[model samples]
Target chain A: MNLTAEEKGILQGAQGKGMQLALSTLVRYGEAFAADRMVEIHSAHLAGSFGAFIYRTYYDAIRLMVKEGLKVKVPATLNPRPLEKIKFLDRIMISQQGFLEASLAKLGVTPNYSCVCYDRENIPPQGAMLAWAESSAVQFANSVLGARTNRNSVTIDLCSAVTGKTPRFGYLLDQNRRGQVLVKVKAKKIDFPALGFLLGKKVVNRVPVLEHLECTRDDLKNMGAAMAASGAVALFHIEGVTPEAPTMKDIFDREPDEIITITEEELASLRSFEKSKPEMVVFGCPHLTMSEVKTLGEFYRGKQVKLPTYFCMIPRVRQELGGTDLLRDLEAAGVRVTAQCPLAAWTIRALGRKTILTNSGKLYYYLHKSEYGATEDCLKFSGVSS
Target chain B: MKELQGRGIISGQATGKALVTSQPLNLTSGLSKPWNLFNRLAAVYYDRHHELYKKDLYNRVLVFPQTIGSTFTGMVILETIRRGRAPLAMVVQQADTLLTSGLILAEVWLHKKVPLIEVPDPQLFNLIKTNDLVEVNGDTGAIRIIG
Candidate 1:
């Protein structure tokens, strides 16, 4: 890869050992992909913050960097941990969380603790380059916001955050971002998450451009998250919806490589709920935005929940909604509002086996069979159980 | 003996029993016991694949099409290696950055080696089956099947 003189200097150990190590790691990563150059990144969002005890090495590695006095050059945000300080963890979990917190604190990273860092922490300008690690966030940044980024891994994001640079390849190149397949939406009411799940399975790493569908920002967010979970899709174009692609022609330079239409039946087929009663209902796999929380509050007003329900959001969003009448009403309805990442929280063995109902397709895909019970979405999950 | 060539993501050499799968593995949840704390065994909860669920991944040749689920997969790979439970080498139909980043971290920080090679050939999967002894040359991008 072509490196600037400064990058070469850092590589030559002109900078600290931490910087040298960071650049060397990135260079190897870039070489694996045959990347020829490095691009400046506007911002970065890192994962691996949960510090789950099994990942002690990750914490130790970061701690070494911190001890070496290496700091992030660009604005950086962290992914949510299992809990902030709920105090239910055993001795081992507590120790792991402590190590993770200390390492991040020493690095001076923002305590955003959100997968949706683009929404709350830092919103890059259109076409701005980024090095973001969270799957859903990377897809949203690339597909919805028109910003460029690859589905960076946790360590790569850390390196990019410190260096403010990433290898210029894959999604960073315009050629790889063009729509490879054309998908038409034929459903009356768009199930954004299901649509995303379907698109991801169909495309499998190829970029798809949606046609003849109108979707909101939140709709795109849900769709992108599910797509990233089900497939390796980093970026997608929705004609007349997303920023970059105003029309089908704008997304694809020529006729799309292939075309697929999504019918109402196809969308319906994606929903398969076998559980009769749900032990828990969860929302916000991508972390709820303020508007989503408000809408949920309005929907459940004066209605008592039959099962335990949890509303997960980032700390900032929780703070914004705290002490509000909406929050109070939801809490009164027996809804538990916490900033914990449900994905990580469910992994706790203490939770045990229980059927979980959620609105997030990504959550459904991950936790369906592994947790010893079925996982379904709220809409269908509500019909059969409640 | 059969040999296949592709791009090499990490450079090293090793031979181990092969465990091949057509489905993508979610290394983060598939190979982790973060909740168990004291349990050093990874992926004890991964039930998606009956063949791999709760199976030992330590020093085996993990063969798969690609990786799916979670950006934390890279971190999981690193942790698995740190616990001495990582695959001896990885052979994938298509190489992804999420898996390679972990191997890269191991090499850079820990001086440990877990070579990865991509064999995009469709027949490559048909040729290499579970329990087959396979040798990998990451620097040369070669995979030799030896009985």
Candidate 2:
């Protein structure tokens, strides 16, 4: 791959050893993808802060870089960390969280611990290039917002954060962004998350254009997250819905590479389990938006939760909803508002196992096998007898 | 011995018994249950294939279609390698940037090399079988099937 004189200088340690290492790693990574050159990235959202405790090597690497006086050159934000004041955390987990927070501070990353950083912290313009790592966030940026980003890995995202550039290949380029599959949605009552799960399974690694589906931005967000979870799809265009494709013709070139039709039965079949008694109910997998939080608050206000219900949100969103009656109502209903990812938090081993009921297709897909029992949709557990 | 050509994502060499899967592997969740908690010994495969559910991935050549699910694939691969429970090498039908990034970080941080090569040919999957002694040269993108 061709590099600019400045890139060459950085590789040669003209900038610093930390930069040389970072550039070298990125150059190797780019070569693996056959990227011709580097593209300047508008922003970066890293995935390192959350799970750094499980993998000490990641924490050590960041600490070393910080000790070398290296900091991110571009605007960057971190994924969610464990809630600092949570009572359930053990001593070891607490220390690990503190260690990660300090390391991130040294690296100059904004403490905006959100998987949905695109929602508020860094909303890139349509077609703007980015280096974001979280799968759901990557899907949201690419499919819903029309910004361009690959499903970048965690370490590679950090490299891009330091350099403000990423390999100019894959989803970053225009030719690779066209829809290859046509998915006709025949389901009248569109379960956005289930549709996304089914669509992802149908079109693995190929971009799909949805037909006859009208969806809101929040619906698209849930759909994109499920799709990315169930399949390797980084981007999808909804006909006349998403920003990129205003019409069917706008998404496909001459003809769609393939076509698949999804029926109501097919979407229904995507649900993993029918009914089960739930020990816990989880709401947010990609972190809840402000609207979602409000809606949940209203729904569960007077009703008492039969089980331990956890509503996960980013710190920013939680802060925005602070001092409102909605927050008070949620707290009164025995709902614990958290800033940490439930998926990552469960890795603590000490958290133990419980039958979890979640509305998130992404969460259900990942945890169904491991947990005692994971059922789709919290409504299934809502009216169940305790 | 039959040689198959592929694109090398991570450069290295290894010879090991092969573990082939027809389905895509979700490196994050498929490897084990949540209760395992990064313990390679207790790690159990949670895919549809029940035969390989409890099989060990350590020092074996893992051949699969592609990686599915989670951007945390890189981190999972890194942790598996860190625990010395990773496959000796990997051969995929297509290049996966998420998986490759983990191998790259493992190479850099752990000073360990696990060759990863992608064979785009559909027939290659049919040609290789389980427990075949395969020699992988990631630098040259060659897989020698030694029977």
Candidate 3:
């Protein structure tokens, strides 16, 4: 594999232990993908939600490596969820704070617990190599910000942090990024949540050119989150939308491999709605923004929901709602704003899941597996109006 | 007993009695219930509703496959280490760098070294059971049950 002089220097032990590990992994990963050279990245967003399996090793590895003279130079970022959101008096977030804190201290990295790092600050340059994993973040960086990144793992991200480069393959390769699948939505101006549910269920890992998706940049954000939650989609081309796919032809890359049609029937049939009395309502699996929250609040508008509904929001977004009549209105309407997501918190145990209703496709999908009562009839009965 | 031995990276290793689980743990999705904690050993995203496997205090090491969960899982490892409840070594079905990274960091922070290994084959599941004593070598990717 070809590497720039700086990267080579780092590998040669000029940069330090952290950088050495970083560069070595980047080169290895690049070689694995058959890439020729490494590309520079501005920001590094670490995986937000990993299990104890990851925590047990990453902290120790960084501490040891950093002692060998490696450091993360560029500003690093992290996924949205903290390890343990509530430590009560401890004031700890993120998994494994003790180990992670020491590891970060050793490497001199600060925590920025935000998913949309590019949105928050310092967007990477177009074609920049990003070592991010979240499907939504990957789509935003590649499609919206025009920053290039493969669906990298936690190890790969750390490697990039040290080496300051990534393998030039996968989404980074121009030829590999073109759309292979064509998906057309017949519904007029699809709802963000429903559209995401329909597409996520239909599209697994393939790159598809989405047609008839009347979405702005913001809607695309929601769509990407939904897609990430349901499937392993790394990139998507929205026809007549997105910067990369300026025209329908561009979406095909060089040529179309296959085209698949998504109809309203298939979309509706994805969810199994067995009729039952509604016991609990849940929202926010991929997470909801202020705009979606507002729309949901307005839909309920003094209408007391028979089932207890917990609307999950990010801390910042939740803070934004503070002191606003939105909070008062929501509470009065029986919509409680939760800092932790329903999936994250077991509010259902307190509320009891006799039947659960949700507008989010992701949340709806998890309800059954989590062993909640089915309330498909209630969701349909609520209609598009609600 | 047929023994396959190789030097391997040990994660969540312990010197106590062995509690081995051949079932693969899925950390991608959330787990709920009294069994959620034990069933989804890798997942640390959900609230601590289940206390089944709260800490690795058991002298025996808990064995399983690759971990799947939210990114901050390193914290869970740290807690286990701090409470002196962590396993002495860990044996995974695959070489999951993410999971390994967390366990290694926890071990380092606690200033202890544990034996860890990625199993030689996915089919090693057929040869192992809970509470079986085995030596793991991550370097050579080997597993040998104590006879």
* lDDT per residue as tens, model 1, A1-386: 89999999999989888788888988888888889988889999988777655666566668768988888888989888776555655444545777777777778788898888878678988899999999999999998889999888887788888888998888888898888999988978777888887888788778998885776787788889989988888998988888878977888898889898999888877665443456667888888888878876675666676667778887798998878889888887777888888877776634456777676778777775321122235622333231
Please tell me which predicted candidate would have the highest TM-score against the true structure.
2
DockQ of 2: 0.66
lDDT of 1: 0.79
* Model 3 CA deviation exceeding 4 Å by range: A49-54, A65-71, A82-112, A122-126, A189-202, A253-255, A273-278, A300-305, A346-356, A364-385, B1-27, B30-147
Candidate 2 pairs with clashing backbones: none
Ranking of all candidate structures by their TM-score, best first: 2, 1, 3
Number of clashes recorded per candidate: 1, 0, 65
TM-scores of chain A in all candidate models? 0.93, 0.92, 0.80
Give the per-residue lDDT digits (tens) of candidate 3, residues A1-386: 87778778978878665666557656754553467987777767666333332344455456667668666766667554432345442222234655565565455454544455555443777777677755566767887776777666555566666656667777877886788888767754365655665565456556778774566665777666666555545678787677778888766746666667766665556444444444556665545667767866776666665656777665567778989888888877777776554553443233343555665555554445332222243333343133
Per-model TM-score, in order, reads 0.92, 0.93, 0.66
Task: Evaluate candidate 2 and give its CAPRI docking class based on DockQ.
Answer: medium
Q: Each candidate's lDDT (Cα)?
A: 0.79, 0.79, 0.57
Off by over 4 Å in 1: A88-91, A368-386, B33-39, B43-45, B49-51
- List, residue by residue over B48-110, the lDDT tens digit for candidate 3: 322223333234555665443333333445444554545656666654434454455444345
lDDT of 2 by residue, A11-32 (tens): 9989887777678878878888
Greater lDDT among 2 and 3 belongs to 2
